[model samples]
Structure formats: C-alpha cells, structure tokens
Target: MKWESDPEDFSPSATIVPFDPPLPLLRAPMKAGLGDRPSAGSFVLAFKDAASWRSAFRATESKILEQCELAELAGFSLARQ
Candidate 1:
C-alpha cells in the first residue's frame, strides 16, 4: 500500500477550503491497493470536521464501493477539526 501519510509530502493532491465559506474543508486520504495489477491510487476528501467527514464517507461509500474499479476502499483517515 502506498500510504501518503505525510501531509507535507501530499501537497500535489492537496487543496484547502477557506473559512470564509463558513464550512471549511478537512483532508481525508484513502488508498486503494488494487490486487497486484498495479492499480492503486489516492482519494482526497475535504470536510470541516469529523461529522462532515463521516457524512462525506457515507455519501461516497456506496458509490465508491459499487464501482470497485479502484481496488478497494483500503482505508481513510482525518485530522482534528
């Protein structure tokens, strides 16, 4: 699994949502290790807090899983609000 755990090293895939927008976004990265076919990638989701994070996860859970073309959900994580 290619885990990009370091936020600093993830700048290329990083983006921020300004607080002026009211609900700023947080970053959640997911790795999909697709078998041994060299089909792996990262998914970046932004939210303001854990609640929003979970909401986003739920929103994408079925849609992402149904596709199942990007390997697997692998896992997801977040920083503090």
Candidate 2:
C-alpha cells in the first residue's frame, strides 16, 4: 500500500491524451552516415488510445506477475525429462 494516500484512496478520472509533437525517441539510428553511431532504440510503456491503454496496462501487469512467478520458481529445484 505504498501508493495508498488513505484508507479511501481514489484515483481521479483520466482520459487518453495525445503527444503534442509526438514523443521523441531517446535514441534512433541515423540515416546512412550522419556521423552518429548506428543504433535503434525505443521507449516502451506507451499507449495509443483508451482501448490500447487498457490492454497495454493489463498486459504489462500480467507480464510482471509472470516474471515474479518465474523468479519464485527459481528458488526451488524442478523435475527434468
């Protein structure tokens, strides 16, 4: 409950918002030879719209849970074929 503000903590209404000029990539590959290193990177955890927002959030949460479960399993020995 680290994020809990109170016993009756409630979240304010939120709507999907668009990026004004589109979020810039932290790092992108330069075209051919502009002198920059050839690298391609992206920023995850972004949603397109309301539906996308919901689905992405749920998917991320599930992935996190799955990873946690895997970590827990790592603490014990497993059967092999």
Candidate 3:
C-alpha cells in the first residue's frame, strides 16, 4: 500500500470520498458514505483509452485469478465501496 491515498498504510485505500477523478485517464471507484471510501461498483480501474487498458491488463494478465466475469464482478461487489 503506500498509495497516494494512504502513504502510511501498506494496503491503503487510494482515493478519498466524493471527488471522483474523471474518466478516460481515470475511472471511478465505487464509494460508500459521502465521507467514506470508494465502494465496489467503482472497483474497476478505468482508463481513458482502450489500448492503454489492454496493455496494462496484458502486462499483469498472469497474476489475475478468477477466470469468469461473474466471479470478478462478485469479488468486487463484496469489497468495500
């Protein structure tokens, strides 16, 4: 975790609540309370262009678990928003 959102924690939540970064370059993370962290629906890492997304995914393709979309969606769903 030493992400910008939580430099202090190892597995820190990246973004703060309310102000979602714009799409394209960035995608929305799911959110909880107006003051809470991002929720599941916005769990995905969105990109401005498809190519960059594909490239990034390909780079880490081997590490990915859960082969099906359903499973993936469910995983994200259970996660905090």
Candidate 4:
C-alpha cells in the first residue's frame, strides 16, 4: 500500500519505516525530532487486503487536505500575532 504525510505537519524528527512481513508494515513517529535527531515511539499501519489498502490511501488523501486547511489557519493566526 502507498502512504502519505502532510508536509506542513511533517517534522524532521519523524521517521517513516516500512517493513515487509507476512503483510506490509508502515510506521511513523508520534513526535517530531530535533534537527537530525531520530524519532521515538512509532505509530504503525499494516495492510493485509487490497480493499483495506485502498481505503488507507483514500484516508491519507483526505487527511492531507485537512492538514493543509489547518496549516493555513495556523499561518493566518501567526501572522495576526
């Protein structure tokens, strides 16, 4: 399955690690890293079926758009500050 993340929310401290087991595995960190620092705990995603994989991709797309909106709002807020 394909994976995506929001650029605005991305942190250098975050890491995306993919593993191939009986199924495909993808993991992301829960927090951002300091410059060049490694990530800590990871959130994991496992895909065992085609339908589920497609669903995950769609969800990621929606999430990206949502994140963009949030980032825009945050930027506007910061500018006002």
Per-residue lDDT for 1-81 in model 2, tens only? 588656454534243455578754333333444444446323323334577667667978999999999977875545431
Best by TM-score: 4
What does candidate 4's lDDT look like per residue over 1-81, in tens digits?
A: 224757644665465566667744544233443533344333323455677678789989999999999999999999999
TM-score attained by model 2: 0.36
> Number of clashing residue pairs in every model?
1, 0, 11, 1
lDDT of 1 by residue, 1-81 (tens): 569577776575466534555554456554434542343345433454788879878879978877774444433222322
Model 3 scores a C-alpha lDDT of 0.58
Mark the regions of model 3 whose C-alpha exceeds 4 Å error after superposition: 1-45, 63-81
Q: What is the lDDT of candidate 1?
A: 0.57
TM-score of each: 0.26, 0.36, 0.23, 0.37
Worst 10 residues of 1 by lDDT: 72-81
State each model's CA lDDT, in order: 0.57, 0.57, 0.58, 0.65
**Tens digit of per-residue lDDT, candidate 3, span 5-79:** 645454346444566686454343433444544554434544657877787688567456545666779889999
Judged by lDDT against the true structure, how good is candidate 2?
0.57
Q: Which clashing pairs does model 2 show?
A: none
Give the candidate order by descending TM-score. Answer: 4, 2, 1, 3
Of 2 and 4, the candidate ranking higher by TM-score: 4
**Order the candidates by lDDT, highest first — what do you get?**
4, 3, 2, 1
